[model samples]
Target chain A: MKYVLSFNLNGLPVDTLVKATDTLLDVLREKLNVVSPKRGCDNGDCGACTVLVNGEPVRACLTIGLTVAGKNVQTVEGLQQDGKLHPLQRAFHEHYAAQCGFCTPGMLIAAKALLDKNPKPTREQIVEGISGNLCRCGTYVEVVEAIQAVAAGKYKE
Target chain B: MAEYVGQPVLRYDGIGHVTARTRYVDDIQLPGMLYIKVLTSPVHKGIIRHLDTSAAERMPGVAGVITAKDVPGKNAYGLIPDQPVFTPEHIRYKGERIAAVAAVDEDTAMEALEKIKLDIEEQEPVFDPFKAMEPGAPLVRPEGNVWEFNSGKTRKIRFGDVEKGFAEADVIVEGTYTTATNDHAPMEPQVSVAYIDETDRLAIYTVSQDLYFHLGMLTAIFNLPMNKIRYIGGTVGGGFGSKNDIHCDHVAGLMALKIRKPVKYRHTRREETAYTTKRGPWTFYFKDGVKKDGRIIARYVKTVHDTGGYAGMGPYVVDKNSILVAGPYAIPNVWVDGICVFTNKPPCSSMRGFGIINGTAADQLQTARVAEAIGKDPWEVHFINAWREGDLGATQFKVEAAGLIEAMKRAAELAGIELPAHLKAMSSRGR
Candidate 1:
């Protein structure tokens, strides 16, 4: 029932034995102590458990820990380089994007996935991209506006 | 006062969300902690005649099993304390807890859930608000007429004479609209971790907005002093009011105490949607009186909300929606009434926009219809009668947040228009 799995986590290689039924969320949170990717809904319906496996955003709660072998995974911690906040992090701060911050991790990962593919997304596209991620604060107006600003290269200036 | 007020500030937490570094309750991992799972009722209405927990207690890796009988101090705990912490008599909703199993690991706790047997009878439940409000319908709660009498803190507003205003109006419009329930869909379903820290106090970590509210509830349920419960609101996952003040935090505290170890509880998506409170699903009835001259004479709105099982802020939702029936129009005569009724469905209380979204949608939609009936364009009637900064509502409250005229004008302009024909005629008549 034990499987030795080795994968790069937040830019560092992590090798551990996990049960066949162990989820990537439990592995990262309980075993490795990289606790940013939360257990929002054990099912993938809520994007709160998103982390990058091979640079593509995936719900850690849905993935089995053993499936992460040999993949270069990334997390919120990897977004910052040497104590400097990521551009998205800075933008979110400047725009008052985080009210409660629980959805921030999953939203960030999803937004990062969108930006990685298309850095210049339209306002509509920004809304569509984040439709999977729901914010209860009704901050979508600010969230969408912030994303649009970042995509249009306005915030960069 | 002249400076820009509506200028958008980049939201404060936007980047923290996108960067994936936010800490939620489940994100906290205490050393040697345990996982807890509950055996909930399969039917919406049932009584726990006998709970056989021997199989679960004998299961390997099972630390302990706690049922409602085991709960010390307060056996009944709810937003109002009418419902028990664990229902011993009847299941009010589909997911009432019967027995809870705490294990050294989450897997074992889940396994123990399969071992519990609950015997009960299903009661014919009240499924609809409209029927539940009728005279012959089965009461959803034991307080037979509490719903009809209180209407769950319904809002009622009256101004001027509605009968005279309606009779003098050139056109009348009325219609019924309904909306469905929506989940806060917070990235985090409710998660709570509790344990006795090194200080020997019952320390708890939960994702919530009002830490003080949860702390008070914990104190009452645990019979422990306020200082005994240490709450660390690590990070809130988009509450949308789901985590505003959870009814489930007590479960976490109970599990940890029963097992005598740190315990964590998190709901799956199904549980999040079916059990935890949600918003939306409101039915609205709006009646309006308007003149052919493009002036609104009177407005009447009746909002009936589905509270969905528990209180869960349903009363507040009804009041909030009823209070907003006028929208932004200038109406000299207005009457707004609301009712919040309980049903067999899952609880839905607060969501984004509180009650304003439902009220606004109904108001705007009704205004649009009234304008059409009176030979006035929707935009013109809406723009001309929109409440201004100093204009008072029927409630005698001043709107200080906005310049309603500028907003209407700019919105009309963006949509590529100035004013409707009736308003144009009004302007020429004035000149």
Candidate 2:
């Protein structure tokens, strides 16, 4: 039996049937074709599948597709408004923060949640913010720098 | 040289993953694709005398059940081909591939896992590498180690005589360092999807670092020419070194060949950790001799690498690790040796930073000891003796663009982090 689900995703209203077993990650990946939220550990140990749920960071892999029935879901794709990339995204690019990039979408979404809550966070706060996401590349030094860059207005162009 | 070798540049792979547009192997779903699930031995070591797949073959949406008999020519494939695709006689490892079931849905393929039955004679397995090499150590492979000399337990890098140089030293320090096996734990686990293209040839998509290496192994395992196999590498979750081992991709391709339909195999997290491998545990011994003025006179290093269950990049990484174990120092004499040994642990291989991180951890910790004996600052000692751009490494060959010192100093200045006083206590005899 097909079920109907209506929700707003990345600023657009999406009405779709979410299989009871399917995860919000599956919908974002399969139905919406948004591939950024990678299916990492899938069990939620590694935060590669994080997204903005009600403007807060949540692990998409853990969320049942039906649970996000009528709520706001923001993915890495919706970070930028208009024709410009977000300041945080620009900082990541400038600071060489991302290597391997497998965990970037989750890192971006996680950082966005932190920034939205506290526009100006200390370096330590930024580290604690994205600590949920793991990078095998050992680029934590640069990742911290990139986030601080955004907070410092180093990304203002 | 490019204008930005050391300069910070955004990773090219960053844009796609950040934008949520990068495609992984499991991300692709073909129009008419089937999924495969393999049933591995529950026991550690056994002789598979029989296999019955009749019930599984008759299930709805079941394509076929493939075993060792299905593999045509060369029934084995690996960096070393001793590991058979399907075991006809004995199972080498725990999850030694015995049989696979292909069906219309993954759940069906998974559900049919219990249907396949096997007859086996269990044997006492040797999980320890050291004991395995001893007189009565039950031979894991029996025919010596799987990695031959080129891939075996030995590497050599020598310079001036070590004994004579050590004889001139006023102080000497030697210690062994051991690190546990850590998983690459790539966010995206291993997944493989194989299908027949318009030409009816196999097209395999997987997460891999080197596509050419995949082509070579797949060609051997599947008995298909390079043209028949098209391997596509997309945004791998994180290969580290696990995906580089062509196990998942090959298994998926063989199933597709037998079923003649598109086959998809995505490993669950548990399956990923169970089926794949991790970086090997290593034991490194470093001996350094230095003059009273804090100048290193000679160095000797012996690295023993536990290759875990199989030899992936163990031998190659050991060789590199041994050289790096020598440390960033100007020494008059050096002799470094490395061995890649097989163990029962999950197949060990490479991780981020390759051998450098592991090797540096051992050597840098040793150098501060040398600095202690001479009563000199570790930083001053490192700066004075650190290799310059054109300085020769252990070999006579010069190393260009060696930024060891510059990078270290610049990092210190930027972070306002001088060598922490606590690091000096690392080599102290008493706690």
What's the TM-score of each model vs. the native?
0.86, 0.84
Q: Candidate 2: deviation at residue B250, Å?
A: 0.8
Which docking category, incorrect, acceptable, medium or high, applies to candidate 2?
Answer: medium
> Quality of candidate 1's docking, in CAPRI categories?
medium
> What TM-score does the A-chain of candidate 1 achieve?
0.92
Give a tens-digit lDDT track for model 1, residues B1-431. 44548776564445555565555676677877888887877887655677789999999999888888767668664455555677666677888778788888767898998988777877878877888788877667776523443533457788887778899998888988788777777766778888987887888887777788767777877888987788888466667677765656788788777667988887877777777777847889988888888888888888888887777677777777767777876688988888778877776667777677987887778888887888767777776777756666887887666566566666767888857554434321111
Predicted complexes: DockQ each: 0.55, 0.54
In candidate 2, residue B300 scores what lDDT? 92
Chain B of candidate 1 achieves a TM-score of 0.90
- Model 1: residue A50 alpha-carbon error in angstroms: 4.1
